[model samples]
Target: MKTKRGKIPGFAIQEMMVVLAITAIVVGMAFSVLNLVQRQMGSIEDIYEVKLEANKLRQSLWIDFNRYSYVNFDERKGQLYFSNELEEKNYTIIEDMIFTEKDTFNVQLEHKAFYFKNHEKKIGEIDAIELKTSKESGHQQIFVFKDNAPATYINHKP
Candidate 1:
């Protein structure tokens, strides 16, 4: 008696291995993209926090500066004092005097030892004041505030 033979045409072991390898590659690529997105989200959050803090500081400074007649930087006390007139106000205008007690933001006056004979512009008449803050040795931001306006120009140079 003659018996009929049939051939199976399904995927072999090698083909299954190849398909698994391709799937692994695709999954790895997907994970890599997910990681990149997460990192970017973290960076954006950090940037937003920094910007918010800067805005708050700038507003506080402008208000205090405008309310008082003069700003005196006391290096010994590590504080800034604003008074209606020198030796007139009994209270010293430090950070805690006007705003919240938290000391996250501190302002220090930089006085150039050499006098600029040509620089006769008064504080209000001056175009702008350059303020700088640093997060680290290499990371810093330079902000420019108009003398009479509340607008601020932020320059982030890292």
Candidate 2:
């Protein structure tokens, strides 16, 4: 084969270094973006978990509240009571009505406030009850109940 002299072609050391630097910058950016996405996804999952727990708690409250004729809360004892009638009953309301995977989620029914303020009376005839849960954050939610028709009239505070 006849050898022919030609100008050296392809990338120089400086060119290679520039390429390497560009590649490193791109990889670093990609890694940072990936990390951010993962963190956001994790936060979303936590929020979903909290919402699911709140829904379950709300459903349980609706079931118990409907079954019993009256709901009462004793602040001093931090206990909730449910009775079929004003006098007595076979089944009573239980304390700590809400449940969550996390032990810190606190659930309480304010029966005393409702009773004293006459909120139950506002419910009127007890046709049906609606439960709604709102997310406070990734770890918490506020559950609210609306009564369709309550039997008695009671006073309430703003």
Candidate 3:
């Protein structure tokens, strides 16, 4: 090779090709990492959604359990009826979802049980509930209990 005294040297064809190949490899690796990160983020988002919904369901049930003077479970209908002097609320479990009077909870239940005074009951008045969410939702167990019941409610039958 020959060059004038004042001229700058250019990259050889082999060196240019090597640099381009290295850049392409780096870019490909970067894209692969990005794709992997995106997939992991998607899975995390799904788990977060499930946990959020489960928390919402727990909070709602706690509130209703405390507010109602009487609680009754209908095994045949897969329903829980909560009633006070002025209002009534119904929670119906169907398939993978729970439907209340005003809202629906998209929670998949793996197990559910109703209890009163530590004894499990299938039908009629109950004071406590235990439920387990599906494995995909982290297998969360939720228990709601109402410790106090009015004398009238305790004496009466529903």
For each candidate in turn, the TM-score is 0.50, 0.53, 0.90
> Distance (Å) between predicted and true CA of 135, model 2?
9.3
Task: Give residue 32's error in model 3 in angstroms.
Answer: 0.5
The clash number for model 3 is 0
Q: Estimate, for each residue in 1-158, the C-alpha lDDT of model 3 and write its tens digit.
A: 89658857899999999999999999999999999999999999999999998999999999999998888999999999999999999999976999997899899999999987778999988889999999976689999999765684559654
Clashes of each: 0, 14, 0
- lDDT per model, in order? 0.46, 0.49, 0.90
Candidate with best lDDT: 3
Prediction 2 TM-score vs. true: 0.53
**Cα lDDT of model 2 by residue, 1-158, tens digit:** 99999998798999999999999999999999999999999989977776766566656556656666655554344344555654422212234343322323333333322333323433222323333333342233433343422453442224
Evaluated against the true structure, the overall lDDT of model 2 is 0.49
Question: For residues 1-158, could you state the per-residue lDDT of candidate 1 as single tens digits?
Answer: 99878886899999999999999999999999999999999988877776666566667656655665444443344334445544422222233222334445433322211111224322222222334444421133433222332321132111
Error of 2 at 139 (Å): 10
Compared with the true structure, model 1 gives a TM-score of 0.50
